[model samples]
Target: MEKVRFGIIGVGNMGRAHAHSLLNDIKGAELAAVCDSSPERLDWAEEHLPDNVQRFLSPEELFKSGTIDAVLIATPHYDHPPLAIEALGYGLHVLIEKPAGVYTKAVQEMNDAAAKSDRKFGIMYNQRTNPLYQKLRELIKSGELGEIRRTNWIITNWYRSQSYYDSGGWRATWGGEGGGVLLNQDPHQLDLWQWTTGMMPKRVRAFCHFGKYRNIEVEDDVTAYVEYENGATGLFITTTGEAPGTNRFEITGDNGKIVIEDGKLTFFRLRTPEPQFNAEYTGGFGSPECWKCEIPVAPGDGDQHKGIMRNFTNAILHDEPLLAPGEEGIHGLTLSNAMYLSAWTDNWVDLPIDSELFHEKLMVQVQNSTFQKTPVSQKALDVSGTH
Candidate 1:
């Protein structure tokens, strides 16, 4: 195929952005069709999208319409896996949005389906295109930062107002969103955490505050601790409560340490690797010699969502590798799931968590929910400055 014909099934905030991207910025992608369950969203598409674009009120219609070669599923967190699964079944390449699914059980099933299909399957982990993160991954993977000892990420700038949650019925409720902050806002960071480091935690223990600042029924604040198989430790702290929040990621290894914050990357390079320094040094009150350097990052961010889309298109048309493979999405979702399970069970959760147990616990939250949501609008909000 010269160009990948794309159909977007959910013109919500992110979906609308994807529609615009596929329509204009992405070169090898053509916006073949658009679908949404919301009438207001369909109206917006009618006004904003080209007349040549096929519009559908239901995703199933668009999937089988034979107008699209690929489908981008941008519905709620819960619908991502099922919609992608169905799209794959219809012999269309599938691209899923973040969180993959609220639960790993469903996402695993979707991954299984993708494995059996001969079509291209990818996830919208747009941040993977950022050059800053790509550089970090290179450093770690190249062994420049030898043997990671500790990692900490404080990505808590996702402050959502009451009006934001009040705008959609499926904003923060467990029945609607499955979980908050971790599920909705922090998936990218969680994905980046494992993606950049190339390691998954051996176990995780987390403390989550449900409805701590929001009026919703799901968690809005969380602090999680994880230990890697090599005894490397990590701390992930995030929330949607604080206004003047911070986003800083620091990693320490045997060679030195690196900090990424405020759009700048800094490195403290040790004259010698810490293990060697400790082994060779005879002094009691000394540390390895360190040289601070401001590592230069490439100017401007990557095409982000557009970049991921273009990469997916290239993968389908030219045999290029995917930047964010759909199956790998499970790693980040695993971290998020471990956090929720640790909090819900009041105990530590291990890697490759018991999906059945997590699903059982999640069902209780869904079945026992009594919170009534009041949606303030059915129209899509301007998602320009937000993730």
Candidate 2:
């Protein structure tokens, strides 16, 4: 195809953003069709979209109408995988919004469909396009950081007001949107945490606070500890309960330490590891005399979402590699599920969670309806004023 004809399914905030990006930024990509169940949302999209674009109220109609060569899914988190699977079955490329899916089984099914389809399938992991994160991945890959010892990130800045959660009924409800903080807000960070380290957790144990913010039935605060296959340890902390929060990611390796925070990438080059066995042990305060340097970062200037979209189109048109392959999305979803499973069972859930077991347990939890009460910040309460 000379140009990729793109249709957007769901014209919510993210849907509109993707539509805007396709219309204005992503070259060789045309906004062919826009679909949404709500007429008001459809009208809003029509107002924003350029003339000569097709509009539909249902994805089934969009798929059958031949108005689109591919569909970009910006629907609810739960619908992402199913929609993408349907689009793939219809012989159209798909770009689904993040969190991949609300559950691991859905991710697996999506992957299965993609593998059987002839079109390209990708996830919108825009953070992977960020220069800072790209640079961190490079540093880790180059062995400049050496054998990573431990990694920690404080990503509480994902803070959401009750208003944010209350904006959509599906925002914080388990029945509506699977899980909170981890599934909705922190997927990118969680993906980044794993992607940059180039490691997958062998097992995960997490402490999740349900209904911590808003009058919802899902977790809004999560602290997960991951043990990687390489014996590396990681701590991931996030919440939707705090304002004026901070975000800092620190990676320590045998040879150096890279600290990324406030748009600064600082590297502390260790002459040697801290352990006496690895270090020369000079017995001095400075010890091995670490050197500090600022790593130069050159970030791509543009909409990251657009960049990923363009990349996806290019992969279809010119055989270019995708940034976030559709299949890899399963990894991130699996990890998220593992974290939640660990929290629910109070056990270290291993990788590749027993899908059947997890489904059974999740259904039990769903049926039991024993909800945990977590404190919501005043700001959160104000946002969810009704509850």
Candidate 3:
């Protein structure tokens, strides 16, 4: 109980990154076991991992081996929910990777299981650790921005080349990864959008351009319009095709506006609330006066994955609160799903999306997909700088 022994299921790129962090960076956490279905990956683990680290051919085997106290599910999108459920059923603490799962039903089932279990559950929403985002959330929660009126995020800087898409067979395919940029690259932004604003869109209308820039079938470019219950409107735009892309997140409220981009947080505060200014002012075209202020955020990339790992271990050991709860991951997934659904149906999609309809549509794509995937590469790519 002194140090949490962690097993990572999937020795892929993100998986190996977690392994390295657990092995070398994170304190009070030990990389006890590693699992992968690929023989090449297992061989790599054997060669690169410590002599004491246990290796398994499958997650089932890893769960049965009982070599670790907890498991980090870093597998593909479809396998995440079932694997997390299995880990939780085995009475092991679980820390699942982002997006939770491809669709909502399976994730809900996993969430239910975790809720019933006494074990600690966390999600690798590493972006939540970013101090700039954390500061934005604080400002909103603290009412420093007053009532939110509009929000916009254009996070297209997730530029992935053809080789990056070709690197894995299971990537960018409906049967494999489910969705493209929204599911893969922009989950963090989607999560941050709702998390920092503390609001979920009541409805979403989106236009998803499938394979607009990439050769893949899934969507690579997306533009979504969302409306909150509080009548706040928002726009989310992203794509992996654009070079020299933008990564700007802006939120406007009655009293102020916050903009986070280029590793800096900026706020524009109004001298008076918009409503008050509108009610009292006689000027027909003038708006409220404002002062621009650059908000200071703590240095560092928030330690990201390592920070989440440390917190997950601590949460299991000392009953500390988790930075990203496993259940809350569904919110972001729901938004993504809603956007996809909206785009598919050519209409607005409501919140708490029709899980059955979405699943049906997804399976259609899976079954009808004609795009063949290339063989998955065993060579791990260093993704430390990508985030």
Candidate 4:
């Protein structure tokens, strides 16, 4: 194919943003079709999008149209897996948004489908393209930081107002969004937590405050403790209630420690390996010598979402490697699901979580939810700044 033709399955805020990028920013990609269940959203796309771009009221219609080589699934939390699986079954390249799906069972089924297909599969983990995180992953993988001992990430900068939640009924409800903060606003961070360290926790204990800050029924604040197989420990703290919040990720290893915050990376290097120093040092009270250094990072944000899309297109056309493979998305979702399960059971949940139990508990919330959501209306929204 000279250029990969693309179809978007949702025309919501994020979906519309992806459509604009495919139309204007990305090369080697064409916005061939767009789909949305809302007639109002379809009308808005018709007015704002190019006249030649085809439009459909349902994803099944677009998938059967056979006009595009790939599809981007940007619908709600529940629809990602089923839509991607259907597209892959049709022999089309598939790119999914974050949090793969509401639960691991559905995502696993989608991954199995993708594995059986010969088409390209990718995920919109755009943060992986950021040079800052890329550099962190490189250092850890290179053994420059030695064996990781601890990791802590305080990412509470996602502040959402009541009006924001009220804008959509599915914004913060369990039946609607499956979970809050972790599922809606912090999937990128959760993904990065495991992606950068190249590790998954063996057990997780979390304390989640449901409707603590927001009036919604889902959790808006959480603090989790994680234990890895190598005896390493981690702390993940996040919320959507704090204003002027903080975003800091720190990791400690045997050789040194690194801190990333306020767009700066700092490394505190030990003059000698802790093990070697402990074995050789004669002094009883002295510690290993340490030097603090501020590591330099490349300028710019690395084109984030657009970069992932461009790579997805190239992977389809030129056999290029994907930055975030669709199947790997399950790792991050596992962490999030473990946290929620821990809170529900008031105990530590192990890795490779019980998929049946999680789904069963989630269905209880969906069945008992009492929140009534307002129907979506056609309104001008600038989603560029939201992400």
Candidate 5:
């Protein structure tokens, strides 16, 4: 195919943004079709999209219409895996939105489908395209920071009002969207957490407050503590309640420390490794000599969501490697699932969590819920800065 004909399956806030990009930004992508359940969204597409771009209320019909060589599944979290699986089965390249799915078991099934198919599979882990995170991953992989001792991220900059949640009935319910904050706002940071550090925690113990800040049924506040295989620990704290919040990621190692905050990357380079300094120094009270330096990262975020789509399209056309493979999305979803499980059971959860048990518990929450969310508006909001 000279160009990858793309069909977007949802024209919600995120889906609409992606459609605009596929139409104007991505070089090797052609916006051939769009599918959405909302008639209003289809109306918007009819007015904005070109005459050649087909509109569909059913994704299967669009998939079989010979209009698209690939599919971008931009539906809700619960629909991601099943849609991707069906599209992959139709012999089309698949790119799904983040969090992979509401749970790992379903996402694993999607990955299985992708593995069986010969088509390219990618995810919208747009944050991976950021140069700051790329630089952090490089530093970690190069061992410039020695052994990781601790990882901490405070990403509470995601503040949402009640009206935001009221925009969609599926916004914060267990039956729809699954969970809040972690499932919605934190997927990017969660994915970036392991992607940059190159480590998955051995165990996760989390405290999550369901509807703590917002008048919703799902978690809006969370504080999770995790331990790695190498005895390194991590702290991930996030909430949608705080304004003037912080977005700081700090990693400390035996040799040095790295901090990404305020759009700047700073490294505190120790002259000697901390362990070596402690072992060889005669002075008991002496600390390792440290020099702070501003690490230079590439100027801008480098296209971000558009960059991921461009890479996805390039991978389909030129056999290029995907920047964010769909399978790797499970890593971050695992973290989110484990946190949810930990909070539900009030115990530490392990890596490669018991997907069945988690799913069962989540079903109980959905089936036996006393929570009811009444959406105030069905109108889509400008999601440029919100998500």
Candidate 6:
């Protein structure tokens, strides 16, 4: 086919951004249909979509209408898995928004559905397409950094105000949004954390701050320590209530260190450690001499969401390889689930987690609605710790 027709399932800010880019920017994309259950959202899309495109109130109707080749899901976190499954069942490719879903089991279900369909299945991990992140991945893969020792990220700059959380009712509530910053704000970061390291955590210990950001229920702050199978350690910290925050990540390896902050990715090439007899080296060993340097990277400018959308369409239409496959999405989801579990249990959770057990535990929380209050604690569900 000369062009890939797209059916967008939501018309909110991110959905509209994708539509605008697909219509005007993406080379091989064509706007074919728009679906939104909300009448106002549907009308807004109708007003914005170019001529010759169809508008529908539901995905089923849109899928039957046969106006597009693929479905782009931008719905709420809870609806992504089922919607993607339904779209894939109808022989349509799917590009789901991030977090994949609120739970790891949900992501697995979506993956299973996509596997059965044999069509292109992908998650919107737009951060992977960022030039800097892509470059970092290449560097680690090339062995230029030697053996990785430790990685630390302070991404508190993801500050969210009360008004932002209040913008949607299904945002911070347990019955609605499912989780907190881990669900909504940090999926991309978590995805990138694993992507760059070429590693998945074998165990995790987390401390989460629930109902800490104003009147919201769910965590707005999280501090997690991860141990990879390769023996590398990582520390991840983030919060939505802190202003004047940091988005700095430092990766230390046997040979050097890479630091990314303020959109400028910098490296510190190490020299040698000071002498153990020296005052700087008080027998406890000393630190290495590191020089700030710049790493070479590619140059590109465009929307990552649009880029991934174009990539998904190209992969479906021209046999192109997918950059962010649907299966890899489960890694981030598992990590997110493990963090919550660890925070609740105050114990180190292991990887390759038991999806069914996690699902069962979660179902109990869903049924216990006694904590009818917003932001029900995992502890409240008889889980573990509190922040």
- Per-residue CA lDDT of model 1 for 237-301, tens digit only, reads 99999989999999999999999999888989998999999999998999999999888889777
Runs of candidate 5 with Cα error greater than 4 angstroms are 369-386
lDDT value for model 3:
0.88
lDDT of 3 by residue, 1-387 (tens): 899999998788788888999999888899999987678888889999999999887677788897999998887777779889988999999999887988999999999999999999999999999999999999999999999999999998999998888876667888777889999898899999999999999999999999999899899999999999999999999999999999999999999899998999999999999999999999788999999999999998798899999999999889889999999999999999999999889999999899999999888898876643222233222111232
For model 4, how does the per-residue alpha-carbon lDDT over 229-301 read when each residue is reduced to its tens digit?
9999999999999999999999999988999899888889998988899999997999889999888889876
TM-score of 2: 0.91
**How high is each candidate's TM-score?**
0.95, 0.91, 0.95, 0.95, 0.95, 0.89
Error of 6 at 233 (Å): 1.0
**lDDT-based ranking, best first?**
5, 3, 4, 1, 2, 6
Candidate 3 lDDT trough over 10 residues, lowest sum? 378-387
The positional error of residue 343 in candidate 6, measured at the CA in angstroms, is: 1.4
Candidate 3 is scored at a TM of 0.95
Clashes of each: 0, 1, 0, 0, 0, 2
Give me the overall lDDT of model 1: 0.88
Q: Which prediction has the highest lDDT against the true structure? A: 5
Of the pair 2 and 4, which is ahead by TM-score? 4
**Model 3 steric clash pairs:** none
The list of candidate 1 runs beyond 4 A from truth reads: 370-387
Prediction RMSDs, each to the true structure = 3.1, 5.7, 3.1, 3.0, 3.2, 6.0
Off by over 4 Å in 2: 273-286, 299-302, 365-387
lDDT by residue (tens digit), candidate 2, 1-387 = 799999988777787778888888888899898987678877786787778888887788899998788898876666777778888988999988887877788789999999888899999888888888999999999999988889999998877787777676545766555678887788888788888989888888999888867677788888889887778899988887888887999999887789999988899987666664345555456655599999988855334787899899899899899998878877777877888888888899988788777777766655544332222111111111111
